[model samples]
Target: MKINVPFSIAIAVLSAIIALLGYFIENSLLNQIRSSLLQSAIILAGVALIIGVINMMRVHWVEMRGGKGNKIYHLTFFAGLILTLLLGGWFGMSNPNGYWLYEAVVVPVEASLMAIMAIFLTYLLTKIINRRKDFFSIVFLVTVLVGLLTSAPFLGQEIPFIATGNSIVKSLLHLVSNGAMRGILIGVALGSIATGLRVILGSDRPYGG
Candidate 1:
């Protein structure tokens, strides 16, 4: 059957209104409606995640068949996917095998990537500091250096009084980081509000535009 776009948009707008009202108002009916809407959203999110996994698998399968990419990577993807699915299905994913796979494979890869990211960000910050010799840039450069030193356990041990966890410099840097994080959170909140408004007005057709 053909879709009713207007009806869908109306329902979405109404649902958003109900959820918003439920956030501030304290009514049993609104609370129940919001709870149901949240459950539906969770279900839809899971469905979307499954669809995305299937799409990725299909793409990898076609590429594997055509020998378009590295066969090792393609086979590895399928092997990991099948293994995870079987393990999760059989043991409900709450068992030791699933935890072992995650800790052994996923954690190390993530840590390596984070190390690489730290190096890249440090390089980028250095470039910025070099290009702009402003007061803010200079302070930022010093703060980043202190943070890097503080994160190094061996070096911090050697320079205990300077970059140790209890050092005044580290405490100051922590406060600065908290202020910066709060500013970022405010910006994110404003951006989300703008996006939600656009979606509610039916101008942002995230479903199909």
Candidate 2:
């Protein structure tokens, strides 16, 4: 008797069995096998990330050599990347210099970008209200304003009525926003499980084999 199987199918079957065994059988050897497999995956992921970064740098470097007008941006990117890596290597991540570099450089830049995004979102809301002028648009605008007011500092402290209103708005936001987030997470988890099942059953071949 002869048994023939595709290499991808064989690997998938083995992986699924090993994963199941790791989960269901609480044996020491099975736990060790699971840990080894996880470590191998992590190492492979790290290698892939490094390769991706090098490839991106090579592409940008090539573009700079081709006299791209965005050479300054590419140069700035490489400069930041190299500086951060060198500082991290030299000072260590927990060192004061590394912390200072992060607080002084990374935090401010991130905050500025977030501020810019908030401004853009406000502008977009204004445009939507002006153009739509519908019931839903009015409701959306009101909701956004209420949300912003609830988050604003000193508004609650200054006015008693405003403080009560902010409290109500915050309660509504927490209830609705948290419920929606939970629903989204549950949906994502279900989708992930279905995909994993498909992959394990050989119905899906993500590796193109």
lDDT of 2 by residue, 56-123 (tens): 99988999999876889899989988888888889999998856668888899999999999989888
Angstrom error of the Cα, residue 61, model 1: value is 1.4
Task: Give candidate 1's error at residue 144 in angstroms.
Answer: 0.5
**TM per candidate:** 0.79, 0.73
Model 2 worst lDDT run, 10 consecutive residues:
155-164
What tens digits encode model 1's per-residue C-alpha lDDT throughout 1-209? Answer: 13677778788888888988898999999999999999999999999999999999999999999999899999999998888778777777678876667778889999999999988987898798579979988887877677777777653364665556587778877798899999999999999999999988888867643
Off by over 4 Å in 1: 1-3, 98-100, 129-135, 149-180
Local distance difference test, each candidate = 0.84, 0.81
Off by over 4 Å in 2: 1-9, 97-104, 127-140, 153-162
